[model samples]
Target: MSISPEKVFEVAALGLGGNIGDPPAAMAEALRQLDRRDDCRVAAVSKLYSTPPWGKTDQADFFNCCALVETSLEPEALLDVCLSIERGMKRVRLERWGPRTIDIDVLTYGTREQKTEKLEVPHPRMTERGFVMKPLADIAPDLPVKGRKVRDWLEEADIGGIKVAGDQDWWRAR
Candidate 1:
């Protein structure tokens, strides 16, 4: 079987979440910004989900989702893009796992495993965070990021109080 060059694109999964400001709108803007990039294409998005704050409990509940994209950019470069989007949204870091305007994490890239000062693929604690796993399972259930499929991990994750929200996509309400 001859592989067509047209079929080549690295799949990157990004986990988006926020508790401050208009999160859905922020996330939508991030998605649009990502799709607008030349190095990437937003291929799939999970339905938005509501989940209680993970490490920081006093903040408002977070709106979360996962974006699946096909990109030519390498892992760290993709991470730079995600951070740029977060900074554009005015993310503040007053504390570790603190509440923020937005958080865009590079969950994984094409089964890669890496750790560096700038980024970590497979997102270190992703499998332990139900807020990350649930929506991820929604869009790419069969993705083998680690040894297990996203859906399989979701079955074991307890990210807590995660519920689907309606009427939103890459173009969410303003």
Candidate 2:
């Protein structure tokens, strides 16, 4: 369904990562594509960071960042947008938590919680991933996820190898 450009939508957050094939460029392209959509708006983006691989630690470290978005699309539709962006970036699903051209995980959609086979809101692993929280704090430090603030979670998470890759606004720096 085509969304009218004039429509408004609930605020949402997304986690983006890409460690292969010009990862930063991949993320920038994805951001540009999302903003080009009439259904979504790229509200805010965090600076870029390089974090030690999460889950599967056998490959390249991921370039991680988070985005604050405004969207007229619902959770499932928004997820479709993310997956479309990944596919556009030449992402192939060969392994879970494996290296990819791009990875976009739906972190939260208006405080909703879901456990469907298609998607999950407040991304099941958001709180546990410092790569997600650190950049998230850059945009919305006080932003709450499942009743807990990003800053608070960051303080509690073991963010050992997450490094600051750049100080510029990665989402709009293209």
Give the alpha-carbon lDDT of every model. 0.87, 0.88
Q: Write the per-residue lDDT of candidate 1 for residues 51-158, one digit (tens) a residue.
A: 999987888999999989999999998888988998888887789888888889999999888899988888899999999998888789999867999988888899
User: Candidate 2: where is the Cα deviation over 4 Å?
Assistant: 1-6
Q: Could you tell me the TM-score of candidate 2?
A: 0.93
List per-candidate RMSD values in Å.
3.6, 3.0
For candidate 2, the 10 contiguous residues with the lowest summed lDDT are 165-174
Residue range 1-174, candidate 2, lDDT tens digits: 997666759889989998887888889889889999898999988889999998899999989998888999999999999998898778999999999999998899877888899998888888998899899999888887888899999998878999988764765676
Identify the candidate with maximal lDDT: 2
Q: In model 1, where do residues sit more than 4 Å from their true spots?
A: 1-8, 167-174
TM-score of each: 0.91, 0.93
Instruction: Find the candidate with the highest TM-score and give its number.
Output: 2
